[model samples]
Target: MDLYFMGTNAGVPSLERNVTSLALRLLDERRSFWLFDCGEGTQHQILRSPLKLSKLENVFITHLHGDHLFGLPGLISSRAYQGGDTPLTIYGPQGLKRYITTVLELSESRINYKMDIVEHDGGTVFEDESFRVEAALLDHRIPSYGYRIIEKDQPGKLDTALLKKYGISPGPLYGKLKRGESVQAPNDKTVHAAEVLGKSKKGRIVTILGDTRPCPAALELAKDADVLVHESTFLHELAGIAHTYHHSTARQAAEAAKYAGVKELFLTHFSSRYKNNEQMDRIQQEAEAIFKDTTLAVEHVLYPVDR
Candidate 1:
């Protein structure tokens, strides 16, 4: 899986960074992409990247903040004209359904495909054979949320060499073996999948958090995650301002990553105060001082979540 950063700025658009929007690209795993937020100019950002709006199957809204929400109606309406015929599902906070419905109604936008909107009060929102998604509230001015995406463990790969020895050529029988089933050969010989399959690999975890101050829910969502995408809106010296605004400093984000024992930390949603590269470097240094595996996540980059 990969994370495509569409926008990295916190509130408003910048010359270099747009507002807060990103996509979890599942091309390798599911051949689809799930969006995290729909900031302003989000569609334009997608046009500039390798992501296709047609492959966007899910949209997750963190809060009703303008930067995180204003682009939703536009993106949704545009999806229809852009060859998006597949059903789409949106998950968000309590007022999201009303907001989206109102905008689409006023605009008279007609969607060509089925769309499901789910408003949750912080808990498990989605689950399927491949993944489960849980949400928790955070310490933001608005009721922002953080999502924990858990990929289910898959069946181990079949041993090709062992199958060759058993006179089992690759065919429909291979599918049965992949599903961890025993199959009988034409000669009346049975072979067990457990004896030939390799060990199952552990599933990967990715946590994407919305705007917030240092909070327990943030750490809970990030616990042991392969990738923790957190917001770093200020420097350590301006932590009081961060708390007052219900935002997190770079150092605070790193501390949370360290306490949560996450494998990697990608800091985004930066304040526009850090304009130049030198100023941005300060934010990176502060986070790295606390957690060495921190990265200043940039816009339009694809970050991989490895198993």
Candidate 2:
């Protein structure tokens, strides 16, 4: 899986960055992509990137802020004409349903595709064979949320060499053996799958947070995540401003990443005050001082979740 950042600037768009929006590309796993947030001009950002609107299967909005979801109605309306005939599901806080339906109704837009809006307060968002996503309340100005995506463990690969030693060639028998089932050999002998199976690989965990102050729920949702995408809207010097605005500083974000034991921390939601690249680099340096594996979420960058 890969994270394609559409925009990273907080609040408003600037020459360097837009607002908060990203797409999690799961083309190899599901042949589709999921979007997080839909800030203004998000679709315009997608036009410049390798992401496709037709492959957008799910959208997870963290909050109801204008910077987080002002582009939703426009994007959804445009998705209808972009070969997106598949059903789409959107998950967000309580007021999302009203917001989406209201705008679409007033605009009188025609949607060729089916869409479902899930106004989730907390708890499990959805669970399937491949993944489980859950949400938790975050410390934002509004009732924001953070989502934890837990990928299911994959089965171990079958040992073809060991199976061949048992006088078994690739056939239906291979399927049974792959499932860890005992299979009968051609000579009327029984062979066990465990003797030849390799170790099962553990699943990857990704935590995406909305605008927030460092809180306990953030810690629990981020525990041991492979990737933790948290908002670092301010530097240490402006921490008081961050506190007043219910946002996190670069240092506080690093502390949370270190405490959560995440493999990597991507600091996003940069305030417009940090205009140039030099200022942005300072934010990363501040976080890296504590958690070495910190990255500033640059606009239009594709960050691989794992190598």
Candidate 3:
């Protein structure tokens, strides 16, 4: 699992950064890729990365803010042009269906792939065999939400030495044993899979928050996450402005990560005022003062999440 930042700017696009779009790459896993918040010019950002628009299977919108969702119509239409025939599912708060439909209608765009929209009311929203996604209401100017993605734990590798010790040869029976099945041997003896398998490995947890102020819901959603991606729209000195705009400062984001027990914290959604890399470095330094694992997010940067 990996997270690729396609856009990191907060409200508007700047020469240094784009708007708020992120791609959760699940290569070598069950899913291919899931996108979060397709901001304006997001497809243009994807053109610079190694991502394929045809592989985008799922999208989660945080809010209806233009910076968060303006790129939806273009991306959906472009995917069809790129020969994306697979079904795409989008989850967001209420009114997303009408918004998307209006865009499609106004643009007169026709997609070859099937699109499914699911409007959620902020709790545990989606669950599959491989992963589960939960959402919570955030303290934003608009009706926003934060999402927590939990990958399911998988069984560990079998102890081949133990299997061989029990006179079990490498064949389909090994597959059965790895699957935790008890089978009868040639000598009428029962061999249990649990006796030869190693302990199960824990899955990774990724928490991503939309634009919001310091809120309990955000902290709860990010609890014990392996990776926490939070918006930091201002410097710590601009706490008053951050509070007024329903956004978080760099220090506030780090504090949330520390409280949530997250292993790593990525701060994005930067204001365009900070044009130089030095300013971003200073913000990251401030965040790191509060949380050691805190870092600033840059466009196209990918962070791997290992299970």
Candidate 4:
């Protein structure tokens, strides 16, 4: 799995950053890409990368803020033009259905694909065979939420050497054994699958937070995550402003990462005041001072999940 930052700016678009949009690419996994937010010009951002818009199966919106969801209507309309026929599911807070329905009604946009919109009340939002997504309320100016994505553990690989040692030749029987099934051999002997398989591999955990101040709910949602993607709208020097605006400072995000036991911290949703990347580097340095495994999120950068 990999995370691609399409936009990193907090409130509005700047020359350096767009808005708040992220794409969770799962090419090698069971599902396709799952988008966290759909900020303005999100389709244009995807065009710059190798991502296919049709493969976007799920979209999770943190809030109704323009920076987080302004690109949804346009992207949905554009998908029809791009010949997207697969079904797409969208999960978000209340009023999401009304918002999208109003947009579609006013614009007369006809989507060629099936659209499933789920209005959540802030808890465990979604769960499939591959992953579980949970949401928690945060201390934002608006009703924002933070999401935690926990991937399911994968089954262990089958030990071919052990199977061969048991006089089991490679064939459909090997497939059954790999699936944890007890099968009878040609000599009418029972072979157990657990004895020949390796230990199961642990799954990866990724937590993505929306705009919010330092809150206990956010920390709880991001506990022990492999990567914690938190918004840092201000520098440590402007922490007072961050608190007033219901946003987090770089140092605050780092502290949250440390408290949550996150392995890596990705600071994003930068304020528009900083035009150059140097300010981001400085913010990263300040965060790294608190938590060593911290970095500033950049647009179009893909971060791989080290599972």
Indicate the worst ten consecutive residues by lDDT in candidate 1.
Answer: 184-193
Positional deviation of residue 106's Cα in model 1 after best superposition, in angstroms: 0.6
User: lDDT for model 1, on a 0 to 1 scale?
Assistant: 0.93
How well is each residue in 2-82 modelled by candidate 1, as lDDT tens digits? Answer: 998989999898898999998999998889999999999999999999998899999999999999989999999999888
TM-score of each: 0.95, 0.94, 0.94, 0.95
Clashes of each: 0, 0, 0, 0
Can you tell me which runs of candidate 1 are displaced by over 4 Å? 167-173
Evaluated at residue 89, the lDDT of candidate 4 is: 95
Q: Kindly give the stretch of ten consecutive residues in candidate 4 with the minimal lDDT sum.
A: 158-167
The global C-alpha lDDT for each of the candidates, from Candidate 1 onward, is 0.93, 0.92, 0.91, 0.90
Best by lDDT: 1
TM-score of 3: 0.94
TM-score, structure 4 vs. true: 0.95
TM-score winner between candidates 1 and 2:
1
Clash pairs detected, candidate 4: none
Tens digit of per-residue lDDT, candidate 3, span 167-247: 788899988887889977777689987888889889899999999999999999999999999999999899999999999
Higher-scoring candidate on lDDT, 2 or 4:
2
**Residue 223, candidate 4: how far off, in angstroms?**
0.9
Give the alpha carbon lDDT tens digit for every residue of 1-307 in model 4: 9999999998899888899899999999955899999999999998897788888889999999999999999999998776678999999999999999999999998887899999997888899877999999999888999999999897788888877777889899978876789888777778888887788789999999999999999999999999999999999899989999999999999999999999999999999998876877889889999999987888887899898
Q: Indicate whether candidate 3 or candidate 4 has the larger lDDT.
A: 3
